[model samples]
Target: MGNDGSGAGDGTKATEDAESTQVYRTFRRARDLLLTHREDYAAAREEFAWPEFAEFNWALDWFDRIAAEERNAGRPALWIVEEDGADNRWTFSELSARSNQVANWLRGLGVRRGDRLILMLGNQVELWETILACMKLGAVIIPASTLLAPADLRDRVERGAARHVVVRDADTATFADVAGDYTRIAVGERVPGWESFADARTAEATFSPDGVTRADDELLLYFTSGTTAKPKLVRHTHISYPVGHLSTMYWIGLEPGDVHLNISSPGWAKHAWSNVFAPWNAEATVFLYNYGRFDAAGLMEQMDRCGITSFCAPPTVWRMLIQADLTALRNPPRKVVGAGEPLNPEVIDQVERAWGVTIRDGFGQTETSVQIANTPGQPVKPGSMGRAVPGFTVALVDPVTGQPASEGEICLDLRSRPVGLMTGYAGDDERTEAAFADGYYHTGDVGTIDDDGYITYVGRTDDVFKASDYRISPFELESVLLEHDAVAEAAVVPAPDEIRLSVPKAYVVLADGYQPDAATAESILAFARKNLAPYKRIRRIEFADLPKTISGKIRRVELRGRENTKGDSRATTEFREEDFPSLRG
Candidate 1:
């Protein structure tokens, strides 16, 4: 697929070029439609349609074309802020030229079309450049985190069939024991027998694709976070992510020239969602604040100084931010959002009270972009994750009857597949088929849609349990527990019981200045009793750190296992309500 123009005078060349033009027009029309109705969610949902593309490369067709425009030529596309107070901003034209050079340099190093490359870098300029260069060359990317150990690297290298690797100099040693014939390229300081990424500067600035990029060509491969089980490889086509993040742009209320900051790790899907695709799709600047440790006050000061307009973070960060001084920053971002996990009403209420802006919550997965989100100018119900975004049809199905129900499994209709949905789990036909069963893509999550179409998230299908024949959503109990003063984080799971089959038990993480003594346990238990239903009451409390997956999600499966192995016994750390006299009538 080298840009040799071998078919310069052939009829096939003419047809391919014309088809590419048509694809670009269709994509632009769809993008412009969303921008036109940015605030009108109802109208946007009713009129929006996913654009069809036969052959397209987003970097070549959309981003490059826009970079040449006078309006966006000198506009900043990427802005990186360092913890040491150093910052750098790259304009649209600069990045376009830089990525072209990188693409040319990589091609010289035997990086061919369809070759899988593992990119493990932090928030830096080269990371963004490589993403665009890979897209231009039609090479598939497997983004791994720098935090992965050698064992994890082996899994990615073997399972992903990686042909090339781009990593920092410090992390090069992690792959020393990883057996592979792949090309090693180091980004920082020169390494022995490894290609230096800095050499790209000497390469030619002009770039040409070997051939047209098909819309359905594999582009990104993501490994799931393994919160419940082993990580699954998810494959996305070119159009799935590059063009599908319009929903995310609309969700964040992004506009041209706006600086958008999203707190997420490099390897995760959320990073791609906001850091690259969504911001660029809206012609906005992607802003990053690199820090070793999270400091809420320092982050707010940067946001205030940099004039950030839109912000998105996980619920964990939002929870941490509220614990600090919410009034630190004189100017809060106009658009604030939380995801990765459901945001509790208590956290949302605190932020709204302090900043005068509601924290919108959105629901999605690694397999797709923002499927359901609280869009701009919409009334955010306290805990609802809003209605389905444009181009998605959400349904709730009963687990037992296999029929549509008001409260059951949250799923997506496959009759009209959303462009953001992944192609499939690569090499896992059984899992993919099961996911697409019943003419829907099962999300493995449960939710209830109100009369007005606002969907409130129930716990995961596996996490939701029954106590005394009453359905209990752990999220509901956790949210109530978060409202208490002493509780910082809570994970509720079912404990074995003879009469009720199972009983509600909570593993709590105490807040600052709070103790794990009897006084504190009684107060938290008393608060739960008042706020929760009788059936959902916490029968026992354990003041300890909750176990979580590497991606920061609570691992209730492990906690459930701990309960199952108890065998009619209690741990020494556990404090039962029966042991407290304050709960006795």
Candidate 2:
């Protein structure tokens, strides 16, 4: 859609303008309701409703409006801290004007509405600018991690049908082998054939949309992390994330002027969830700390210095943070939450003991926003991922009988679809149909609901196995293993056994000052036996690094494969319960 250079006087334009205002107001009302009931989960659930919209552009109708507001205009919208102590901050009005210039610049380069653009950038100001600019231009964004290899880049370009690419200048050589007709744009030092992103600053500061963006118009296409199999393309509409993250904002307890720091890399959905949508939805500043390597102490220093009030991090980061000095920070964030994977109870306990704040757990997938979470001021049941957030109807469905159950596959009832849910798996009708079957959207994860409605996460449906006909959740055994001071991380999988079909086997990573010897394995196994039931005890243990996806999720699928192929011979590093006869009864 091209701007015909027409002035804003036509009847069609007038009607569209009125519709846009109506949708913006509707969105604001829903957001304000959640903010008002921040601590009152029951009231938020009772009063909240997803705003309906026929035509809406979040950047044009919502972000721009907020940017111009007197209260928010001068407030910092984004703050980035470098590892070397360098920092940059952008205000709401500054970003609004900057994104407009970028939008105008991109339009001049032939970028059009509905065109798919591959955005592979690190945590930098240009990343945020391109995001808003693309939204204003109605371009679909395909976010990619900088860690992706050239083959992965080719897959994204081909499968995503990308028309444009924006990446760091150092990564320009990566595209040399990835063949595409897409336009190339670089953010750092100018490349020979690539367009300079710095040129966007010289374009017009004022922006005009070529056409109206419908609420359901495609905005983002995310590729899953491929922890189990090939990555699936997940599609989201203009409203799904921009307006949908109110639940995430509520889950993180974000408020106006709050500085929220979420430890996540760009090119992933979690980045968009916390670093982009959730914090901004509440008019809070999105804070980022860029570092080449993870240093827990350094991160904490920045958090304290930045006056961060709300903090969200993946389970991996939380686990590492516990290994460092927890009391180093003079002031810990008041609001702490964990996602990506379930936080082990031990890690939560350590943080709570040090900071006097519990690490709330939230459950969701790439297909939707926060479905279940421990809201602020709620009694967080240990190991439970709280109740369903407002606007979502969560149920545990029996995979076989297709009926609601107290324990089964965690799913969302499609009868009343939540605005936060994705549209579908793009270009894969078979997968989409299967996911939306049985009147629900299957999360492919298992969980159990207690009488009080808190949901405890079981392992993935594929990861859960049986031993002696008794069901076993790998997460449960892993959690027990993590409780030991010698065990840093552990992944449990079934190994072939002569009797009982199979038995639980653990692949563990040792903590500092712990050796990877039989003595260490024996200590961990003994600790597990004392803590876990007999049926779920660790029958065998091996010291090794856990394989993980780029997003930092454990790949149990690979470990299961390794066990299936291990025909009876065990590695020298593996220790079996039978080898240690002293413990046998």
Candidate 3:
């Protein structure tokens, strides 16, 4: 047997097959160990090791094997419920066969090994099918968001060197101006110049790889959210995401047959993190509730009706969820986690009171998987994002000294490089070298570590500033502001001051039923003064929507720029602390 699905191969191929089997067994052993010690974080960290392999194809080896097993083949692998009351489900066996057909069809259309393909689609069945098919076919995938306009599409097509694009039929027009020779394939209704994704149904249901896939082969290219600057291309190998997500599975506490719901949009790294790799790695069902607009009550209904056992959501969604009637759902998920940003303590406290499950926070980036997290059964300290996950060695390095410290930049020690980390920034060797320089992958984010090894996020290196010569963490002040009822969301940036070099200014988004008036500003400012230190208090507030990346991360860089250019002038919406005499203590 060979990796190419040929039986009774020559001596070299037979030897290759034996190596492949050993790799599979080693990977399975690691996965099973984590599952066994799911709640025992200490045992898991001390025992777990990343499986090493020379040649490995996760889709061909792991997923296909699980699909053929009698115990797992019939289990539901994907469950999607739409807002219009449409429901669809697919078993492991079905997706395996469907992906095979898609692979064969794609190969016929010149999608060969090493070809770069842009996958832009919603939470549809075709997305999963195509992803599996691409893996089997040994094609590199560049996942793009549908919200991208023509200019953004052009950047991906040109910079990514994409050889093909599979997107929604309606979006085909956006590509008209994106000049490229890439093959166009559209889902949904037919387009004149584009191949219909529906045609895959008529292709052969059995497929075979043309050659063996090395574990180090390029697999996924993700564009960073670009909160501060232009998006950088992050590259991952075949083993990095597929095998490395074992840490993610353990962090989420996923188990076999568990139905997990992760609230995220397609075309982002987090979507693949939870929606595809993490859940499937644990042999759990990936459940999704697709909606045009986020309705907290409606989403809760689906979670109850579908029996979602594990849930993962961003901090933004978690904040909105708390505003709704949380008790409407009869059953809440047993396992819950928050990512994308450091969740506020107030939000976590509210969720725990309503549902009895603490919202554990995990920290990572587009460059890596969950590096630090509050794992299952761990004592989650308020405002801390837990400890280093298994298989990762995390350190806080002082920026000036470049040495390990108690409070500094959060970094990953590359002495034992984790499997979930990306290879480097694609097409930019200089940036890649800078990131991996000094024997550590600098995360560009700052944090503090306690005596117990728990790491709490402070803020991005560029986002942290000084106020009256005292270090100011915007996240800390924003957390206090979020504790107020008048604040739906808040962002803090440094504003120029004459007496003190700079002062903390807050941009607040009022919650429902709250007016963005002088009274509301005073209430929020007074609350911050009561909770935070005087130096960290929000001295000025402006009621306005936060500027964010399309991925929903607040772009504090933009707010900082706005404040710098404003000089001494004040906007109509701005309110200063001096305007209220009562708040002066």
Candidate 4:
């Protein structure tokens, strides 16, 4: 995306002025309040306001304001570096203009309002440009990570009603089998049938919207992980993600012009939640380090060199980050966060010691933005995921009675109706009704809220097992296992048993000094039994790394499938709870 925001004055002056009067004033106040209470969660939630607007296009309206104003005029909107050392950075001004050019180009190529487009590309400048251009066009975007297989592509094309496709030249082969009436355009070199993206740079830099995007227009389509079934199509509207991510902006505590680098793949909802909308909404520069393989050392160097003010990664990256020397980087970012799942305290502690900053944890799903998080400047409970974001009202309902409880399924009240929520799962009305039943939108995951209003994530509703007729939260067990010297990481799943019906079995990874043998397993089991309730104690242990999804979440479904094949198939280093004689009583 490359042009002149001043050329021909495509966007009417009166419209721009009106946006400045009302919408921008509110944004300024919200942003001000977020910075003022960056450290206080309760204060921020109580005080923050979602910007009120009759009509808005974040790329056209808000981003343009920031560039014209002093706050983000010359600040980098996107900063990129390749492994080979070539790099370029786009200030907010440059990015906004470039997006106009791309928007004009895409319109010329038949991309229009409400038309669905599948965006698949690596971490390149065009990716960001296309995002802004699409937003300006009011088109629905389905973000696809380049890692997707042909099957995944076919699924998206069919399910999402894709009218256009924008992909990298390298990834064109994956689309060979995907049959659709969509326009094909590729970013790098010329593909046989696809139009060249290289033409976008030559297009005029100014673009005027055919009409103002309705705040409720469908903006994004996402395919969920679909563990028990096929991936569900999730839909988000104009204000749903763009404006609703004020919670995410506050959760990460990014300020205007701050360099924020969030490690996530391109296609996932989490990527858009943080990488595209949230950081840019905060007026923060999105810094990316493109690498083939994860290099913890190289990442740290980029952070230091670029002065990344805020950083975020999922538990998978955090797990690997701890394995590397934590203190290798000279300067660590001030604000850091972990998402995609609840992070272990060990990783948090290790990073704190090395960086002098605590790693805040956030929890949300594909259907919503960050609902629960440990906000900046808040008193973070050891394992708690902080508090509900500004626009969300969280309720932990009793699973049996649906009454408010300290620990239960994490649910959002439908009464207040936060904008961040999806328009319900696309094309599955029955499942959608179930998800939003009982005046609440139920998140399948379970969590506990304290008297101070902090919420701690428990395991998923199905993943939390019952052992010896006592409900045992797997996260509680996993937390205890992580405390053991020999334990690296663990996942507890129900293993079928003859007497108990099902028992808690841990799949674990050993720390550096330990091995997967009877002695190591016994020691860890002893440690768990000593630390846990008698009924909640882990009855079986397997010394092996936990299996996870591509996004790094523990695949309990896979483990559950393995247990189904056989009544109880033990791994090479399996140890029964009864193996240790210390608890014969």
Taking all chains together, each candidate's TM-score versus the true structure is 0.97, 0.98, 0.98, 0.94
> lDDT for every model?
0.90, 0.92, 0.92, 0.83
Q: For candidate 1, which ten residues in a row score worst on lDDT? A: 1-10
| Arranged by lDDT, best first | 3, 2, 1, 4
The weakest ten consecutive residues by lDDT in model 4 span: 1-10
TM-score ranking, best first: 3, 2, 1, 4
Model 4 steric clash total? 3
Model 1: colliding residue pairs: 1-210
Would you list the clashing residue pairs of candidate 3?
Answer: none
By TM-score, the better pick of 2 and 4 is 2
Which of 2 and 4 is ahead in lDDT? 2
Estimate, for each residue in 1-585, the C-alpha lDDT of model 2 and write its tens digit. 122223566776776667666766787898999989999999999999998877777888888878999999789999999988899999999999999999999999999999999999999999999999999999999999999999999989999999999999999999999998999999999999999999998999999888778889999999999884679999999989988888899899899999999998899999999999998889999999999899999999999999999999998888889999999989999999999999999999999999999999998888899999999999999999999999999999998899999999999999899999999999999999999998999999999999988999998999999999999999999999999999889999999998979999999988899998889888888899899989997899999999999999999999999999989888888999887876575
Model 1 C-alpha lDDT versus the unseen true structure: 0.90
Q: Could you tell me the TM-score of candidate 2? A: 0.98
- Stretches of candidate 1 off by over 4 Å are 1-21, 568-572
Across 308-369, the per-residue lDDT of candidate 1 in tens digits comes to 99999998788789889999889999999998999999999999999999999999988999
Encode model 4's per-residue lDDT on 31-72: one tens digit a residue: 778778887767877777677666767777677667667767
How many angstroms is residue 269 displaced in model 1 relative to the true structure, after the best TM-score fit? 0.4
